[model samples]
Target chain A: MPRETSRDNMLREKHGKEIDDIISRYPVRRSALLPLLYLAQREQGYVTEAAMKEIAQILKLTPPQVYETITFYTMLNLKPVGKFHIQVCKSLMCALVGSDQLVGWFHAKLGIKPGETTPDKLFTLSVVECLGACGTGPMMQINDDYYERLTEQKVDQILSDLKKTGACPLKSGPFMWPEARSAK
Target chain B: MPKHELILLKNMMTPGYTGSLKDYEKTGGYQALKKVVGKVQPADVTQLVMKSGLRGRGGAGFPTGVKWNFLPKDYKGPKYLCCNADESEPGTFKDRQLMERDPHQVLEGIAIAAYAIGAESSYIYIRGEFVLGAHILDKAVAEAQQAGYLGKNVLGSGANIQIYVHRGAGAYICGEETALLESLEGKRGLPRVKPPFPATSGLYGKPTVVNNVETLANLPHIVNRGPEWFAAIGSAPKSTGTRIFCVSGHVKNPGNYEVPMGITLRELIFEHAGGMRSDKKLKAIIPGGASAPFLTEQHLDVKLDFESVAQAGSMLGSGGVTVMEEGTSMVWAALRLMEFFFHESCGKCSPCREGSSWLTQTVRRILAKRGRMEDIETLKQLCQNIAGRTICAFGDAEVAPIMSTLQYWRHEYEELIREAEAHREKELPMAAARH
Candidate 1:
């Protein structure tokens, strides 16, 4: 509905066979919507109208159907987020262990609040539900990787490191949320 | 500390155990699948699991074998075994660990469960945020297929067990079985009304079995060792098997610990999890996930079994023990969990959608020192009205924190209210003149 900048069917054109493979896995074509949505999000940072329309066409659903699903899911952004989308876990487990402080540190460092992207479009901050990394309480997911057991200094280092290297070396455990010292 | 025969997390804790096909095979995995696939009858497999006294690790605590048997006996067309990897319950993280660290264990379990239920294909509906876990599972599924443990004619048993990992796009309600089925159909994750459970009609209108990751991961181990072996392991008869308690919050060692089910809350916290982070005395414990009711330090010796925890006014719902020290505020904790519920309430049912917001606001107001004594009564009525009125258990779950807190820590709520009353009284005369 916003300016339809992405006119091309980039989702279908680029991820045709891959999409086909995913669709084939399910008995119904519609079931591939989540996977295709993921692909669209991966191809671009956020899902575009053109992508949703294309997904609807591919899955044989109405645009509203696709739009409704997009709206329901928190991860599927309607607009483009910054290069690094930092989703801080604000659920009770993380809350108990200084996630609010982690959020404050992010605010001070980024000059932006939750649900806002930086002017430079480098980092986007959003408060999210538990990512199930409960043990390592004060955690955030920057794009795909998790940055856990955060402190003010660690948050500063992570941001600075991301700004410099396009990635944070402190990103942790896909499998294990290691002890703070061991993680470092 | 008492010993635990950690079947689920054993391989991951082993020295340099790569979770590859080779590593899983070396660790005596898939032996159960091979033993049971063609040799054992489907009903008999279910019987074996039933005998093992295995119950669902995901909140409900329903017997896994009984669940498998619910699939319409012989009318099966396209039955599904949906592994509920949507471990989004706040304070629960055992599923992510199982999938990421020991993918084959889960995959093997899925294969066995599918064969047991006569389901050819199974889908692991993993939480979308678990990107690494999903990727690991995808690779594991591929590896299992290549090794003939999955795909057409598994292990020459003529059992075509195929496992696929499906990712949910950040909806906690999708963790609910019927809601999960709806999402699997690429629709909004709204729950369907009961009468026709997933076992009767599920996943594209066929019979289905939705199971938890931790529950399914136990299948292979149960099959390898006899039913008697598993049944004898945990708290007798009812609650059987090792539970991976995700100890978080104000704990010295806040991590996953797989122990026998009968351990007391005190033993779990003090011995297994290394006690409170500081010298601050223990205040409260949400013995299960955020959905379960909160327990105070008085419930320290309450055993972590499903029935015992339920007897203590909380279910062993997902085994996510969240400890809070004396410094923490219970009302604030309730507010935090209420906020999560308010955010995640899929607006299918009016009671949940509207009640969650109201509950959250009331709790928030109390925590912020702006609440009245009447608001406490309002909160109680709201929780009561909402719990049993929804299509899903979410209604009951969302109210757990508020209801439990009000029950145990009534004094804290009163203290806040009294402060609000005093503050309001002081400001009243000045406000009256201004008005």
Candidate 2:
């Protein structure tokens, strides 16, 4: 068992109300584990060891249980990632639509392969399976946004725009929240 | 022959439709819920759905009403309704479109389902990657609740229904109903064994009904228009209603198209999707998502309904019609699909865990030009061993790509092996000369 640190106490204080709201959704506190993990990821870049311990403590489970759940999911990263985590869809539909070539193009331009963050920590390239934008294949998700119907030229433009303004110009459908777009 | 009417996607085609609750209500969205809540009994709602002949859209094609009727009438524990919005199938994106474009329609469907099943609380287990869709659903649910459509004696019917959106953390198996429930309970998405199906023992050991998003989305139309009207829309008696076919890969216009259930595959591909991209000769098609068996050009005229597609040696699994052209490599395609299944296997059972990994490595070896002639036989044996031996339908699904490809295109695999051997033979003398 890892000892509690001051950072854990700070996270608890910051997200205490949100954590309570998440726990209240389920009949069992243990069921709040995944949402709490997402909250922890939002606090930090990834699910750190201390955060897992804090989540386990909050849900009344052991650290090992939470760790097992984390390992099972591909999205819940155990280590730190870059600011813009670019996950290119490499499933059957996307691959057929040239996602493999898109990944290769990213590798050549970014000077980094899949699963590696750049020295500047601005980009992390990963080839993930099926983001459910099959019709608009060869898609990639940067942070919370999905950039679909991609070509090499589009990838070039997106990367340059992100490098310049910290945001990509292209916007595709099946958003995490289009309502937020209006709010912004 | 009357043209097939779009029920679920009617609002989607409306220009400048923002998928708002107001927009949905203007098109008569929650009128079914308003009518059914306080007036109609739960059993009557189930009967109406059964008579409408609506089946599950998330692969299995199980009758939705029959599934609802499975919950023991005598059980005293809290009944739950879980709307499965975790649409992660490789070629399937219909549910995502429905949720993102018309979320209130989906919620209205969920409310109706909750009323029919006597579930006071319902949850939509959306895919983790669908961040935008989740946010839209959150807003839609809140909007519906505020409008007296979802929470606290919904519409003054004395039926308190609360809907929550639960996001999954990027696991494909969570789309499986039992695994979905397990994940909703905040655990690893390993599918639970059957015989104790969700209707009896589910979600905190209570009676629960799990439904697909598209399946539930049809509830409003079925309730609004009578069951007879709904049934009359389909080309066939069994597969009654319009289905949104997601066409991708080598199609000129790759997108979701809503058509009657019994439309032909050729019509879906050429007529609706504007034919193949670049006028390339069509080689093969996976009529449903990655899980369905691969169909060749000979099966193009087959109907797109659940029963007809099954009769043609494939399933209308999620209606993800993935078209492949002549220049495309079948071996490479199968390898990529095998890679997906291998990565997604839940590892609860030995057969799927070992078999998917083994098949993936074998296909990779073949694609790398290192495969022997005997490897084809080994691949078939592995497929045989994996199917029907696992906890869920995943084992059978994982084998579909391999088995179907081998059945339809054995010569492609053989040709690759022959080319590899020829290349190796050419390299041997040069190696000896260098030495």
What are the Cα lDDT values of the candidates?
0.89, 0.88
Model 1 steric clash pairs: none
> Could you give me the TM-score of model 1 versus the true structure?
0.97
Q: Write the per-residue lDDT of candidate 1 for residues A1-184, one digit (tens) a residue.
A: 5446576677777778999899989999889999999998898788888888889999999999999988999988888899999999999899989999888888888889999999999999999988899998799999999888888888888888989999778987556643221210
Superposed model 1: Cα runs more than 4 Å off: A177-184, B425-435
Model 2 over residues B1-435: C-alpha lDDT tens digits? 115566777787666788998999899879999999989999999999999999999999999999999999977668999999999888988898899999999999999999999998899999998888999999999999999999998998899899999999999999999999899888899999997999999998789999999999999999999999988876658999989888999988788888888889899899887799986889899998999999999998999998889998889988899999998888899999998999999999999999999999888877777677999999999999999999999999999999999999999899888876777765665553332
Docking class of 1: medium
TM-score of chain A of each: 0.92, 0.89
How large a fraction of the reference contact set does each model reproduce? 0.74, 0.69
**Candidate 1 lDDT, B23-109, residue by residue in tens:** 988999889888998999989999999999999999899999999988888784889999999998899988988888889999988
Query: Chain A TM-score, candidate 1?
Result: 0.92
